[model samples]
Target: MNDTPGWASPGSAPSDGQDATVPRPSEPADSGGASSKWSAAQPPAGQWSPPSGPDGTPAPAPGPAAGWGGPSHTGGPGHNGPHHGWGAPPAAKPGVIPLRPLGIGEILDGAVSTLRAHWRAVLSVTLVVAVVSQIGDILVQRYLLPAPVEVDPNASPSEALDQAADSAKASLVALAPSLAITLIGTLFTTAILTVVISRSVLGRPVTLSDAWREARPRLPQLLGLTLLLPLISVAITMVGIGPGLLIGSAGGVALTFLGGTAAVVVAIWLMIRFSLASPALMLERQGVIASMRRSAKLVHNAWWRVFGVQAITLLLTFLVSLVIGIPFGIIAMAVDGDGLGGLLSGSSPEFGWPYLIISGIGAVIASAITYPISAGVTALLYVDQRIRREALDLELARAAGVPGYGSDRPGHGPTGG
Candidate 1:
């Protein structure tokens, strides 16, 4: 027998006072009155032990020690025993958030907490990725536009044809490398950023270098996940002449209504199912398939909650973008209406300094603000599920190096028994 503190052992009871070694009367009565029969029933400290069987073997041990303040009575406060200072009242089960519906405020608070704790990792990864993505955007735009055919009004038809051929050759040479760099940079940034955000939001410590390292191995998987949507879109387009006709038709009332509804439903489901995938990948170090499986399991019955939170986050991000984008768009329109129109119509203006600078700066600001919120909310939701399902609050407290049963802390419940 290990003789460790088995649950059945008559060990020192929980402390009622700071110094709880001192024994007190088992029952209360008048000061001078004879002790009650109940007082006599409790064995003295030194003699207390479980009743032995006829063969003198001790009774089997009770279950593992209950936590200091769990819902069940393990001879702790609010039970039929002397109250203790260390153990919470039976009513106070630590680490269990009440099973009330989560509100927007609670979700927001969790997000803020996540950002405050992991801002360094989050900001570093986000800024790096955003800059890379923006650079890629610039490169693709500047050098990748299809060459315009040169038309010489004074030249004969053959000479004009020769000029157009030369222009086409020049355009292909300029555009190919720029397009490749842009695609590669965007892919790398998305994978690494997803891992970084996932880990940071889950209350784990992750460095930017470490995130990049972890993400590298799973880059292919992330790329596959990224491309899955576009491939599906392409498939849908190929499925019917309806899609092509919808595009040409001015009012796609029936098609638009059906497609929009279907898109929203699928989007909601994907958001919920994959909400935990990034954290699973980063923290559990699983590949994309495994992480996705784990995420699907965790989110099985929690789809609505996930959908609500993600939808709200999207709304928030959209509003923030609109606030910044609307003004910048108006300014851009006012400054160079013709250039804006030309840009929209897929015509490149002569490459200029001012337009790029303003657009680039606005893009960066919008990305920075919106990226953290979206990432933070996902992380918070992951934490909230762990707390709800696996008693993760206590584990987190232990990780944070807080003592059990100390004063309550904000953003956390007490330790479970």
Candidate 2:
């Protein structure tokens, strides 16, 4: 999917914050084909034993122990098979994910489950963001947008084409402020919701205040990161089109189209690769550049998986928005008649505040529901990547206060549930 090593992230530093005597394991527990993808590495009951010390004394219970299948992380004591196949203890549901690798459905379900469990916090963040974004869009549409140059129904073809071009130009210009608002609001909400989702994964209650306090300081960098991606994308796209413009021939035009398409493909790839940046930055407290680097790294081995989950999430949100917006759009059209058509077409036809307000209301409703889903999926994806790479599942388990796990270990905080 990538020409270079851009998709690869630096492996997390393997550390020992668990019991001193029982060494931390580097590899993960191996669950063979029998178990489900996201199933936990369930040793038989009482198999989680502490390792023996150098002098043969039993070590204390380990905290952030090794991943599944690691040498140090063999069954602790009174143990049988290291990886239980049949009748393995059921995966603990203390948090969103089992204490193991995550399946795609698990990630998506975790996002929705968090929303269901903590609707108050998720909806609160999204409500504010949606209002802000809808208001901006409405203002742009009503005030800043250029009046549509009404195309003469009987005009010559060239004249109508010119009018169409102008209308498109006006529409694009009008959409700028709305686009900016959406991006900024998404960054803000993503930050806060990442914290919410992180806490939710531990089955801990997270307040809006807690999310904001943890996320607020990273707002500026998040803003930078959000803006940078689009700007870089646009620049890359222009590079694709520039040569065609320079040549200004039919062949040049064809080249430009091909370049633009190629550019779009690359841009989407980059976006998916960096999709986990917000979660990484907000949770890891990293700077924008470092977070992006980390995201690219985490996305390395899992590009297709990430892309699939993101595409599914994107499809879901789009469907929800469309479902919510359609009835309101029809209502607006009925209420405002041809004026609604004229407004959309960039032509003036007694523009009414009622039409804009109704449409904006629909948008707000849709946005409020969709924002949390988008943010939650991205955050969970980041967590999933860390679990795969750094054995973050153990850390998360400890944070969630799962028994048999060490408490207050490094990289696991903000909850003791």
Which prediction has the highest TM-score against the true structure?
2
> Which segments of model 2 are wrong by more than 4 Å?
1-86, 149-169, 340-351, 406-417
Residue-pair clashes per candidate: 2, 13
- Per-prediction TM-score to the true structure, in the order listed: 0.55, 0.76
Q: What lDDT, from 0 to 1, does candidate 1 have?
A: 0.53
77-171, model 2: which lDDT tens digit per residue?
Answer: 21222333343444445766665567778888888898898899889989998998888888877778776666678977556655755775677
Worst 10 residues of 1 by lDDT: 1-10
lDDT of 1 at 405: 28
Location of the lowest summed lDDT over 10 successive residues in candidate 2: 1-10
lDDT of 1 by residue, 260-329 (tens): 5666666556657876776555444556676667677667667887788888899998998788877766
What C-alpha lDDT values do all the predictions have?
Answer: 0.53, 0.72
